[model samples]
Target: MASDQPARRATIHDVAKLAQASTAAVSRVLRDAYGVSDDMAARVKAAMKELDYRPHASARGMRGKTYTIGIVHPDLRNTFFPDIFSAVAEVILPTSRQIMMATSEWTSTEDVFAAMHDRRIEGMIVVAPHISENKLVEAARQAPLVLTHRHSYSTAYDTIVSDDDAGAELVVRHLAELGHKYIVHLGPANGRLATQLSFVTAKRARAYRNAMESLGLGKFAEVAGCPHYTFEDGYRAAHEVLTRSRRPTAIFAGTDNVAFGVIQAAYDLGIELPRQLSLVGYDNTGTGGLGPLSLTSVDQNPHEIGTLAAKMLLSRMDGRESVERASITPQLVVRRTTAEPFE
Candidate 1:
């Protein structure tokens, strides 16, 4: 039998047309607005039911909802962070949520937070933010927040991290097992004059020093300051360390980026990796696995880190108020870059 109704399903506009009411009136009825009259409300409801029309919660709110989540990271170009971002995106997709990224660098900080505050985002994920934990906690009062790599212990927000100290110990133990005692930990600058601004790196360096001393190699424990996480700083530090009269048998780089710089310096100095110099990096970022580099490193499994952060954020958004803190124990990925020291 031929039907009189249109082939396509009814829409809000169709309901408005059939009920002889303005779209605003229909909107008012849907929102239970004060001014909508009895006749108008009844007409809108009848039309909606006749057409089996459903209202989307996102479409109508006192302030309106955007159904968006904001993600803020310090450096968008860093290889390690992107893997986390990819994992977060995959988790968000099934929920019909849109993911917006913010770089805490430059003017983007203002733009990103403005979106978080003004764009009506239900929640946010921040990685290695430069801001203090208290400031972050203050911000969390306004919205649900999940922080990664920021040393957050606030009961007001969620935090997830790969245990940096333990990860460092794993590296030191691995090197020790491989018969390397002359291990030099290359990271932030060393000594009373040394300064390391990020707690994550500072913790790793401390663990490295502690591990070395505990291994009865305290006299040989050396910390080379790279000034920063930048590759050039790493290269310069490595150059200084490797070009010495007594070079380290192994190097535990603070992070993979630093390791990349160290690797370059090794090549420039005509040193063979795992032959003349055994080296390892932290943060088994995706790029480190691509065969040519196949870096022996500590695996935080950024994908897992991101997934945990996302789950916590979503759960927090669902009105669970208790603070959730999670730590993923790290693993050592043995690759081409490490080997036993030749006698």
Candidate 2:
């Protein structure tokens, strides 16, 4: 009638000993593998129930699958990816799957891939990767793969991308609507175009150029050179663009962070925002809504993007091969940073 104390630190051997069976029999029962008789399995199950024994993960990994997914991102400090990750976690909450993560830091892709391999992840989601198309295809051979904000030229793995081109067009149209004829687009460096990564920054640059041409301001549209999306990069680019003899009446930035830098540069040079220069940015980060900045920008909806990418990855992992890519439409979030050109 007395309650039995919980077995301390349950192990496979302890379960086998309690069940009066071999270690192999206990493992077979735990895994529900073939060849174990009903009575034998029942005995082992009863022992495990009594002992509260759980199989070691390393041991479980040996058989075949672990139901784990890996995610590699280029930067974690940025709010965009963190928002996306939160969305992904929401989607994954109901599933038995687990996620492992790594950051690339614009360094060796091999190191990140190796880290994932060491964990024996069954699938992967790589965001804005720096690896080559051929290398991505090769990497996919190790696991089912999903790409976010990047594309694979191999057509082997599933990809989900925000419509950067469409987003760029929308930005240009917004500037035109604000009655600004002279606009400059501070763009990512040429290396972005040459890289084999699916999330090519040049795609947005091209969109910026096309939008200007379509609006009949091609002659006035110039792309300022920025090697990276940092505050200093934006500040320098904005300074050069603003100081020109024929200064741009308006400026569009590729990212919110870059726009912040541009705004700072404008203040440093004693230029009034929107009154002297209509500034717009992409990514729609929190700063866009600040009382001081009020930056008009495009909302890429990183949460929705991350959710779609996670769903795409899960579908592929669950054996749904046909759903290779998911495209989420973007919207322009208009705010105070844009206005009619000053006299």
Candidate 3:
């Protein structure tokens, strides 16, 4: 259905011509060279985007750097993911490079890898990739890559992850401090890969159970979860927990999106949050900041994560390719959704 003849990709001159800016002015804006006004930079970027102008990597190759990178995110719908995406954008914007984004499900990373194959994309930033470790290593061999959220000691690629285990412990300890003996851990059952050492949810779930048992509340420790990380999975997992013979007084949902589903299910069951059921979510996403949601969650500080990942990829693209790993600390933000269990 498409034309066989390849269309001409827009060029930097086209952007400069349309923006009414000189070639030097356009170059300075893209390279983040000093002295470009905000207005000038904005105008150049807008014109470039409008014309779909891509600075050819081939031309930059003579200068020993490609002006393009690819970013693959976990999911498009998850509010938490977009924050990370923007963070990556902020970090790369000033470097005179471009970022092309794509979404990949926990089930497949093919769409993401396809972006990597583009000749223009000299480096990749894969956020919370759901593919296997083996596949990741192969991909890294093909291009400079930085994997965020997936943790491993392999020297093949770099990684930046938050302390998810500690984060889960914080939630468990907070619930225990609240006298919530009967607590449930609701999370995605993202198959065997979820059980891998690279997966954050798997780490969090293990930590939650361990923390609860360590507090001598082994009798109340319950891990009810499903295989997918989505709203429907959360609703079903929460519904199962609430419909049990003895419902938990508090719950720790894996992510904020999942917590939203739990909230709706609880509301349908006439359960008031924090009064009848307390909840804590992970990845304090944008939606969680809403007054109505005000979700208590673990803040992974995805901004930091995204920025760090971009920088790491840049380092790799700069040819410093030994291996690097960084961990960002996680913090718990208590909100209106969590409270002391009722009598």
Candidate 4:
């Protein structure tokens, strides 16, 4: 006769017993708690494998640690973001903590933050958040928070950013040195508000103007506003400027993605790159290095930024209270797209 009872599920106690370790040790192993030895971890993992043990996430959350880190970003379509994500993943690989990503593509940033909170994420890394400073500070109070690409000052959270001013200066000076007097900047629409806000786009735009003025080309300096950082906005802005009676000899795109659009627009308009018009973009994304594209860009060291953000988040999670602000220097990579304007 067969019994009607369901099979028993393995518990932490079972794992501890099988591994000849205490329940506390098993718990620490499960949490990836500090001071855990490799030998102990190996024994516990072996026991867990043999018993097919799986820890309940909800139960772990009840104890105040979910062993999960949340990453909140505006869009996943941006290639530069993936570099940061990969670097973060590599840093967190040796730990038991896992990553949970949430994008503001379909939902609001508030909703995404709420969902991450509901899941009890131990730490959070917010990339270029569009939320207000007050809301961001409030979220930081709820969990360990690290911000990337945002320059707002906050004592409650850590920040990792690139030197946007230096990056913009590099692009402007590079173009100016190439004997291009008429230079146009294509940046986010809100860049005009740089005087009021610390937004990255605004900073870059302001820096570009300052550089152009210092180089005695302020009269010819122009900025064409893009609705967003997408390729469509870039294309639209480029097309508008390119068709003008007094066209710029060079275009400084705010981002690599936008630069790609500028390239396509140039192709459609029969403007020969480097020969007729020069171009420079920010964010040295991998695709910009293609043999045909050969986009000149500013390298913000996104991988290093990502690594720093992860480490800071972990430090905050481990009870570090002091806020950290890390800024990475940008480098200009000159490619084939930029040259002296043809006579």
| Strongest candidate by lDDT | 4
Question: Candidate 3: misplaced stretches above 4 Å?
Answer: 1-66, 188-194
The candidate 4 region of ten consecutive residues with least summed lDDT is 189-198
**Once model 2 is optimally superposed onto the true structure by TM-score, how far is the C-alpha of residue 312 displaced, in angstroms?**
1.7
**RMSD per model, one decimal:** 8.4, 6.6, 5.0, 3.0
Ranked candidates (TM-score, high to low):
4, 3, 2, 1
TM-scores for every predicted model: 0.79, 0.80, 0.84, 0.91
Name the candidate, 2 or 3, with the larger lDDT value.
3
lDDT of 2: 0.80
What TM-score quantifies how close candidate 3 is to the native fold? 0.84
Model 3, CA-based lDDT: 0.84
Better of 1 and 2 by lDDT: 1
Per-residue lDDT, model 2, residue 231, is 74
User: How does residue 156 of candidate 2 score in lDDT?
Assistant: 72
Which portions of model 1 miss their true places by more than 4 Å?
1-63, 107-115, 190-198
Candidate 2 runs further than 4 Å off:
1-56, 151-153, 192-198
Candidate 3 structure quality by residue, lDDT tens digits, 1-343: 9999999998888999999999889888877776999999999999988998878667776765567788887777888888887888898877878777777764369656965675557789888777767888888888888988876657888989899889999999999998899988886545664577568778887888789889998888777765566788889999888887889999898888888889999988888999999999999987987999889999999889888888889889778968999999999999899999987
**Tens-place lDDT digits, model 2, residues 166-270:** 998999998898788888888764665523235547777888888999999898877888656667789999998888777888988888878888999899888
Query: RMSD (Cα, Å) of candidate 4?
Result: 3.0
